[model samples]
Target: MTEVFDAIVMYQRDHKEKDLMVKMLTRQAGKRMFYVRYGKSKRYQFAAEMQPLSMSTFEGVINTTGLSFINDVKATRPTSFLMTDIVLNAYMTYIMGLIDAAFVDNQPITKWYDLVAEAVTKMEKGLDPQGIANYFEVQLLPVFGIQPTWGQCVICGRRDLPLDFSEKLNGTLCQQHWDTDPYRMHIDNRAVRILSKLAEIDLHLLGSLNLQDKTKQEMARLMDKLYDDQVGIHLRAKSFIQQLTGWQNRMINRQSSAKEDES
Candidate 1:
């Protein structure tokens, strides 16, 4: 049966010599695969709408156990920036990969669908992609069977003290209990606060990230360690994001040195 639904185009690949296989996360039908034929037909004409990270409305047959087919399509959101910006594309790829990792195929998760749709829309509107991605990563932890204690200290259950993240403790450590874990990550307190905020943030209401560079760096380190220790899944897209960040940092350093030399 043909059904109408909104979806995010996750990724696509060549199916055969003359067709493409498109994978989309549909709001109503979950993740479904559709075949976009390469011919002068309406399906082929709308094939461009299947670009990665783009949101579109689809009229298609959604099957539970096999490949579905697309009948018609139209863009549901403005994603010109996602198509043109390489960095945004990288973030998009990583975000899509993350969703795939967190859930299985053909599983209808409307809440997660809404969250991911809002996140991509935010990114297209020029919000910080890394910040949005970070929020998603934190939210996905529970799906990986990790429930970090971000609300209160794991040991003393205190909420009034400054907190530090302890991978060994698998949660936050209050100032009074910091000595309990010798390996507690002594990151910027701001990082811990941001993680707490991210844990409860609504993606629909989240604003632009206004974090200090040091705080962002510290948060990244802490999150990386946390994921490595607890959730061991790795995606190549994440490594690409790291490489992009490395290049950005190096370019910033080069420009700073050039300015200092001129001064």
Candidate 2:
């Protein structure tokens, strides 16, 4: 029986000597692997449609075990920007990796499918991709079996005081209780506030990031620490983003030095 569904191309890799294995997060099913064959000329026929983060429709027989097979592929949405924009591609890659890590195969992923779709749409509409990525991370924490309290202190339940993240407590620790956990993450309050906002904000209503460099750095650091301590999943896609950030910083420094030399 053939089925039709829309999905985001998470990634594809070599399946065999002559075939490719494509993974997609489908609206009808969770993460699925499809076996794609090389064309007559010994080239991948659906290369463009299989690009990571591209929205495509798959006509195939979905299987309960092993790899499903795709009979036809169609572009369900425009993804040229996602394919061409390196920065967006990097962020989306990390986001997709997180989603893949959060759920198991063959699980019903209707909500997750909607979330990924909205995140892509938000990025497409010029929302801050980093912020959207952060939002996805915060929401996925629960799927990773970590439910951090964002509204108030995990210990005292007070929301008025400045807070810091605590992996031991699995949530925020108010300043009043800082001594309770010696290893509490001493991040900027602004960054902590941003995390709380991301945890609660709707993806549909998410707005401009408008975050300063220092705040963004602090937020990213805190998130990396928490995920490392709690989730313990490290992704190469995330490492690639880190490398990209380093390159961007170096490029900015070089341009700044060039301007100083001209002056």
Query: Highest TM-score among the candidates is held by which one?
Result: 1
lDDT of 1: 0.84
User: What TM-score does candidate 2 get on C-alpha atoms?
Assistant: 0.91
Clashing pairs in 2: none
**Global Cα lDDT for candidate 2:** 0.85
Q: What stretches of model 1 exceed 4 Å from their correct place?
A: 39-43
Q: Model 1 — which ten-residue stretch has the worst lDDT?
A: 39-48
lDDT per residue as tens, model 2, 1-263: 89888888898887667777888898988999887777212466667777778888878888988988878875568878888899899899899999999999888798889988998888888877777778888999998988999957999999889989888888999999999999988999989998898998877777666877778788889888877878899999888887988898899899999999999
All models, RMSD in angstroms: 1.9, 2.1
State the lDDT of candidate 1 residue by residue for 1-263, as single tens digits. Answer: 88888998888888667788888888987788887777234546775687788788878788878888888874467787878988888888888888889899999989989998888778867787877778888999999999999968999899888999988888999999999999889978888988888998898988777777778788788878877778997788889988988999999999999999999
* Per-model CA lDDT versus the true structure: 0.84, 0.85
